[model samples]
Target: MNMLKYPTLLTALCVSTMLLAQKAKPVKQGNKSHTDVATVEYLPEFTREVPAESGSVFKIKNKRYNLEIRLWDQKKVRIVSTVPMGSDTDTLTNDELYKMSGVTLSAFGKRIDLASDEYPENRVAEVTNIQVQGLPAQPAKNRQDANGAEEIVVEGYKTTTKKQQANVGEVTVVGYKKGGTDSSGKTPSAFPNRPVKDEPASIYGTQNPQVADVVVTGYKSTWTRTSSTRRNMVVYIPRDCKLVVDNRYTDIVVNEDLDKAEFTLYRSNLGLRNVNELRVDASFYTMYAGNLGYADLKLASGSLTAGTIDNAQIESTGSEVEYEGGNTLFLKSKADRINVENVGSVGGYKEFGELRIGKLSQDLTLEGKSTHVKIRQITSEVTAIRISTQFADLRLPLKQLTGYDIDFKGDNSTVYSSFEKKEMNANAGIANSESLVAAGVTFGNKAPAAFHVKSDESAGKKTSFNITCNNCTVDFK
Candidate 1:
């Protein structure tokens, strides 16, 4: 025994002891800290992590519009709005916009002049490829003055107005909505204006009065950059028109001809609590639209399910996701290369890909050729791990693994090695790896209740140990 190396071992032991004492959860730089799942939003230029209750409704100028906002109760933000009203221009106070629940602005006549610092460029820009749906319905049939002909409701009128370099402006009838003010129904004359009701009508009439139609039309234009500095743009949506998210416009786009200054989309954070459906569609990358960092994912409490590749390729170079609470994590993509860490539990299908876990609660089944499957900790009473890789090599530093069942089935594909100090009471099967190392498995102190290791004489290589049990027998041909 060399006594000099004992001093070096003591020094290493001391350093490792301090490191283990200081061990903590890995923290990534620039990771959006989410307090709750519901208050997270992923927009082009806007990345905000707000509290759950910050999502509320308000009314502005008797018009109801949903003010989707990202609010951090602990911090402060600067909000600005420039709106085009009729032939005149108007500006709305942030406080006034916050008071609106669902505001309806006429689409037939309006141009929004907007600017904001909440954006990156310090300039408000127009959003093209504007798609709107579910607008207010058309008014009831009214007779025309000329020929007693019923007026027709235009599907969506489109007309060209002005054209400039790179910005060809046009107004198109977009969408419509229902509720706002009662311009449709006029006050009826009571017996030729004999006398108005002294008091209001019965109860139900107190509800919101219905308006005729709320049409949204505007010149969807694009702004070009003259300088190299990053441009920030704020898109102004009518208070009533809920911004719809599509895969085409869900990412940031940047190119030589047109560069993206900044992009963002926000919604009232109410669905965080009641939302049971979570869909992830990630397949595009542009200056205007691009892959949203994990910071861009919206959080909800419903049973979570993800589609095949939420985006085209989720590049997890220096990123990790921290989930608050979920029972299951389903990987539905084919031949997906998903990098996951720090999840509570997995209760779904994990047929392909490599899963590296800091902790696990259930069994992990790897049937296909998965090269780097690793498990660090088992926080359950019983942990079952099944690996069917072509070359199944188990390398884990688990502390309290009580039971295990391992079945290896591959030709010249499985490599068996163990560094466990204590023999685990496990049932294991090694087949067709075409290596003699499989016969050298030495059960430490405890052996599997039933063990089977079979290979033909031509396939048998060498054995370094024999069976020690009187009741248990080993047949080697």
Candidate 2:
């Protein structure tokens, strides 16, 4: 960023004055009118001073003219011509010299600000206040783009200003904002960019109309079911979505538009096997429902919030399973741990039973209507567990869950387990939620003796069940 120098304006005017004088002169053809001009010659001459020389040399039309001229620090003007009509030598008349030097330094001085040079700053006037003084009343004749690439020249002045305000830093910006509309705008948006499929609404009053599309915003998600289970429900988790995973566990987010969400489930010799570890990764998927109902809903790295409507039930069987979507998801029996990384506005219903999680690292949130959630064995390090309710109790093995920091947020809930009864001194806190003890010890605020649990080895190595409450309470018997 450089400043403007006013002296340069004078130098430019010297050339402009000469041009003006040439334009004013009319042509006198042999037998033609004044408009019948033939041609005009513009000869620019420069006089150079040879140091230690008696005088100087003038270069005119590539020819040298020996003459005497004085310069003040190479910034002086000199002119001498043999043509008496346009000469500006000492012997020439005032009118002749003035006409020869048609431009005065003052004229050029007024426009020196436009020069890209370093000099006195703040020379360029505010373009808004300064109008094009010498412009013609009407605009110049319009010019069309011959090759369709329209280009127009814009001429204007620029200025700089500064304002100081309290508590805020000084803001400096260049002001060149004023101009006509753009000659070329961007192309319009395409028509009906794509297609969307229509899905029928559920008639059971427990399900809403199926959504053909699901868009994920930020890739953080939570799959929460509440404290109740009026009946068994199935939620289909899809597979065509993004998955973010670390060492402990993986996250699933099904945020994409699909024509349909369907799956087939296979029944194992047993139910969901607690013997083998399982991992869940989702994108888009179909499921196979064996004897038990399965939900073919895809869980991405987003909030897949669902609650039991009537008595819907859904749980994945630990058997040979395969699913298909835009992208195939191979959710093998290697790991099956779930967590709610973050929460957003989620709308839907999800139900699960016979919980079998291989690992649990992040925070897990469970809430819904008469929903049943059971995590048989959390064989991995636990971060935090939060349980809430329309009506339901979270059941898990206490010995398998170990972490220095464990947070329990539940409401009117109960925890039942059969992994190990050994009590360890672990810091536990509760919030506004109530707690119930059925078959094992419960961790939360309000604890009642009616929910006490008696551990039995016949319940198995990793056997657990939970009775979350909605509007009703039941017994373990």
Q: Return the TM-score for each candidate structure.
A: 0.32, 0.21
Question: Which regions of candidate 2 fall more than 4 Å away from where they truly are?
Answer: 1-358, 403-446, 449-477
Candidate 1 residues lying further than 4 Å off, grouped into runs, are 1-244, 247-277, 285-325, 334-353, 391-398, 414-477
Q: Score each candidate by Cα lDDT.
A: 0.28, 0.25
Worst 10 residues of 2 by lDDT: 214-223
Error of 2 at 223 (Å): 45
Q: Write the per-residue lDDT of candidate 1 for residues 1-477, one digit (tens) a residue.
A: 665769988889888988865442221212211111111111222221111122221111211222233222332222222321122213544434323212132222222112221112112211112222211122212212211211112122222222222322222222221222223343322222011222222222333221111222222221211112122222232222222232111112112111111123221111221112222323222112222222223222212222221222222211222333233344322233344443443433333344565555554544444334465665444344544433223344334443232332233222232432112224322444343224434554333332333224553232211112222121111
Best by TM-score: 1
Q: In angstroms, how far off is 84's CA in candidate 1? A: 9.8
Q: Highest lDDT: which candidate?
A: 1
